[model samples]
Target: MTQRNSSFPLTRRAALAVLTSALAFGAAPRVALSSSPLDVVATTGMIADAAMRIGGTRANVRALMGPGVDPHSYRQTRSDIVAMTRADLVLWHGLYLEAQMEQFLADLGRKREVVAVADALPEDLLLSHADYAGRHDPHVWMVPTLWAQVLEGIPDLLAAQRPEAAEDFAANWAAHKTELAELDSYGSDVLSRVPEGQRVLLTAHDAFGYFGRAYGFEVIGIQGISTESEAGLNRIGELVDLLVERGIRAVFVESSVSDRNIRALVEGAGARGHEVGIGGELFSDAMGVPGTYEGTYLGMIDHNVTVIAGALGADVDPRGRLGKLATGS
Candidate 1:
C-alpha cells in the first residue's frame, strides 16, 4: 500500500445522511411535476454520461468536473454550488472519490435531491482501499463489467425522479447494457492477448485494480488509491528496480494526474540501462473532450484497452475497437 498524503474527515454514513435527508424532503414535491426533464447535476463526467444516456431527454444533466478534471481533489465552485442546489437531482460518485467535495455535497444534500450513485454497488464486488480502513476504491469504472453493474440500477433512480419516463429510462438502459457487454467483451479479448509476463499495468495511481482483476494483469501504482497519496523516493526507487528486473518496457500516464512521477520512473530506469517508455495517457479519473468519442464511457475504456494492448506488444488496431479513437491517441 502506498502512503496516503491526506485523510478525509466525513464518514460514508454521515455523508449519506445529509444527502438522504435532502432527497427525502425534495423528492416528494417534485415527483408529480416532473413532466419536464429532471435538472440533474453530477459530480463527475462518467456519472453525467450515464445520466445523459439513460436519462436522455428526461434529464438535463450538467457535470461539475469536466475533461482533465481530477475529482479526487475537486472542490465545489460557487457556480457549481449554485447549479447543484438548484438542480432537481444531484448525483455524485460516493466512496470518497469526491474527497474534497464530500462535506459541501453533504451540506447541500440537506436542501436538494442528492444521491451517491456508486454507493448502490454491492460491497462484495468492491476492492477495499489500501489506505482507508473501511472504504473501497472509487475507480470501479475501470472494469466495464463492474461499471455495468454500478449502472444497472440507474434507470430506477432516474425513474424515481420522473415516473413518466420510467419506460424510456429502462429502454435506454437496455440498449446501454448491450453496449456495456460488448465493451466488456472487447476489453477482455484484447487485454488477453498481452503475454502473461507482460500483463503488468503500471500507472500513476492504483485506479486500475478492477481492470487488473477483471482482466489478468498485475497492477502497480506509485501512489495509493487516492491521488492525495504521496509517492516518496524510496517507493519510486523500488518500482524502478522492479521495472529493470522485470524488463517492463512501458508505464502509463493519466489524463487527470501529473506525469512527473511516471517520468521519474522512466529516468531512473534509463540510468540503470533499462529504457522504459510511457505506454500512453490513460483516462484514469477523467474522460476526454466532450465532443469526441473518447469523451464517452465506452470510448474511454476502449482507448485504455487499445493503448495498453498496443503498447505492451499485443496486436491491436491503433484506431481502437470502434475505429473512432483519434489518430495518435
Candidate 2:
C-alpha cells in the first residue's frame, strides 16, 4: 500500500474485460442452511453500495447507517453491536466516522474479519480531519478512484470470510470495476463543462474536497469536515460576503445534514444584494431512500452529477448521463 494518486484507472478497457470475464464465470448464489446471502455489514450507505456493486448475487451488504442517518453522530445500538460481532466480515468507513463504535470495531477485530475501507486510501492526499492529528478523510467513497480501491478490497474480505466463495467474489469484483470506471468518466465529463472561474462548489460541509480535487472545482463548505465543528455566525457572515462578491447564484445542500446552515447563507447573501438559490441537494454522507433508483451507489453519484451539472448551467440534462437516470436517479 504505497502512496497512490486517486486518479482514474489507466487501463479502462482492460479493467472492464476483467469484470466481464470474472462475472461470466462466477458461481450461482448458494443457499446456506440459513437461506440468506453472506452476512455483510458496511458503516455507511456509500460503502454498502460499493460492496453491493461488487458482491452482486454472491453476497448481501447492509449499511448500518441508512439514508439521512448521520454517521458522525451515529451511536451503535445493542443489536448493531451484536450484528458486528457475528458478521462474516464487517466493513466501516474508518477515520472518525463511526467514532461511537470505534471500540466495538477494535474488539470485534480480534474475532472477525473487520476492515476500514477508508484506511486503504493514501495518507498525504487526504484532507486533514484535524490539523495535528488524523491522517485521512473518512469520506473516501467520494472519489471514484479511491472508491474503486475500496471495492477491490471486497474480494479479499469476502474470501477471508468464506474461503469457498473466493472465486465468485473475485470474479464479481472484477466485473463491477468497469462500471465504476464508466461512472467516474461520466462525472468528470459533466463537471468539466463548467468554466474554471465558476467552478466553486459551495455546500453544507467540507465533504467535497476529494470530489473537488478529482473534478477540478474549489469546494467551500459552511461547516467543517466533522459537523461537530461549529458554523459560527462570523463564519457564515464571511462566506456570505464571498458568495455575493463572487456573484455565485447557486449553492448545494446535503441530503443527510440540516439545510439550516445553507438557508442562513442564502438569507445573508440576500441582505448583501445577492440572490442565491438552493442548487439542489447532494448526497454527501448517505444515499437516497431504499428501493429507489438513487438508493444504489451508482444512482447516488448519478443524482449528484445530474443536479450539479444542471445547476451550474452545464449543458447536461438533470435526468443523468446515458439516460439511465430516468429510473428515478
Question: What are the candidates' C-alpha RMSDs?
Answer: 13.7, 9.9
Q: Which ten residues in a row have the lowest lDDT in candidate 1?
A: 1-10
State the displacement of the C-alpha of residue 117, model 1, in Å, after optimal TM-score superposition. Answer: 0.9
Give the per-residue lDDT digits (tens) of candidate 1, residues 12-52. Answer: 56877877886888874664465888899998999899989
lDDT of 1: 0.90
> Which window of ten consecutive residues has the lowest lDDT sum in model 2?
27-36
lDDT of 2 by residue, 1-329 (tens): 23333334546667778777766776223324333568888889887877776666767787889899888888888878888887787999888888778887888889988888778767776776453164456677777766897667778877766677778778887777877798899999998898667788999888888888898888888888877677999999999999988888899999889999999999999988899988888999899988877888888888887788778878887778667565332
Write down the TM-score of every candidate.
0.89, 0.85
TM-score, predicted candidate 1 vs. hidden true structure: 0.89
lDDT of each: 0.90, 0.80
Candidate 2 lDDT for residue 57: 74
Candidate 2 CA-lDDT value: 0.80
Relative to the true structure, candidate 2 reaches a TM of 0.85
